[model samples]
Target: MAPLRIQPMPTYMDIHEIPGGITADEVAKAHAHDAAVEGKYGVHYHKYWVNERAGKIFCLCEAPNAEAAMQVHREAHGQTAEKIIQVEPDVADLFLGGSEVNSAGAVLLPGGAADARDPGIRTVLFTDIVESTLLTQTLGDDAAMELLQIHDSVVRDALKALNGREVKHTGDGIMASFVSAAAAVRCAAQIQRGLAQRAGEQSNHPVRVRIGGAAGEPVEHGNDIFGSTVQLAARLCSHAEPEQIVVSSVVADLCIGKGLMFRPLGEVSLKGFDRPVHAHSVEWSA
Candidate 1:
């Protein structure tokens, strides 16, 4: 037998079809799930399009291979995949590379006016209340909303402390942006620890929060993050345990020169994104 020849991971796309009549509420729920899984797996290029004409849902993602992408979809939402296709990242990479180059060429000093022509790579933080489903089930709907208001308030307070901007709320979840990867990770850990303290004080109803982050050039849209990087951050938070913070290799790369320590969790190929993205789950308070 000849020596084994290792093959390069084939870049591909995974298409999943969600059920028809997926309501706005369902889309919100599904999007949350998608974001969380994407974050956990580090797939930074995902686009969703609904096709009512064919009564099918379209999800375009970059992945190392069909198998890896399929695994992501299955593990993320337990959804059965419909189609998977091979792709050449070279073409898309050219476009992505150009964007990065343009961003680097621009000089945007902090607190100074800068053109919105570039998509500057930055860290994105996503935080959300944990066990929200059980809470709503136990507490009345109105009471649940009131509790969420308080939870949001606490989160906002901490975010403000860190000089972060809230991207938006996906129901109980909040997406935030930061200039520094270390700061974003630190802020996430802080929120988790602080929320845990608050939860410990509540004997009847403890509220926990899960946090995750990714650092990359997130497409900016007003105050919201609109790129695959942002989606990946939210996905990481979704898969995270209460008070746990998960980060991507992109974030890990940014903190290389910095002194922040990280515990590596090996590699995971997220849905729709080509190549395996190294992942790390930051050590937080037990």
Candidate 2:
């Protein structure tokens, strides 16, 4: 007989969009109501984020399914989420960070115990050295290491300036997360321009990098960020040409009116994704 497979409870992040704006106190009350009724549907409401200025509320929960999670909200406070996406616990934690909550169940900023709230959204960026293996073969290990060092320094500098957190070093490049999509876009442009300047200074072993970015809420899969957002960012990076920056439509839309120039690439097929994803190329050169 075949062995039975047990399905794990799925984690979900739900977004509530309030037009004018919402207060932390109001969200706290709604969360209390959710907690009161979640048990009935076997849903566990973990933590929530309130962006008063953005008029957005994000709730993290685990339930049998998205519908079950939404049912809890309907029963609890009649505040249904505008959208809900299934996420992995670890990925959600990576982007959302520590789970410290106040007395009202709202998540606080990593170290800020005072009334500040985390918005629960992040823009993930990936940078890859174009033809890294070929470069290593042509330049040998020592020279390749030097090129990598240059890439590291330039990317780190831009990250520091833009308030981006380096998630991990990708050997040939870096992976970072930012609170603002515009900042992420700006950082990518800076990295490209910096590399171009460096190439001009050094004729031999010119380093060219490809960058990609995508914006979304926290979703986890494994120890690293293996969510769709991260995947999209990585795929876009791979799709980019040397010295080019590619980003998802979501990232481009978020940067609207932010003075960033992007040429739409229409929809492009990517690996591991069922449908084609809309992409844009950032014009980062002078």
- For model 1, how does the per-residue alpha-carbon lDDT over 144-218 read when each residue is reduced to its tens digit? 897687678777887778767776687887877776677777777777776667767765666677787887532
Worst 10 residues of 2 by lDDT: 217-226
Per-model TM-score on C-alpha atoms = 0.55, 0.71
- Worst 10-residue stretch by lDDT in candidate 1? 98-107
Model 1 global lDDT (CA atoms, 0 to 1): 0.61
List model 2 lDDT by residue over 1-286, tens digit each.
9999998798888889899999888999999999898999999998888888878888888899999999999999998988788877765665655567888888876545476787766899999998889999998999999999999999999998987888789898899988788999999999988998999999788899999999886533322333778899999999998888999998999999999899999999999888999999998773
> Model-by-model lDDT, in order?
0.61, 0.86
Regions of candidate 2 where Cα sits further than 4 Å from its true position: 1-23, 30-47, 51-94, 97-117, 220-226
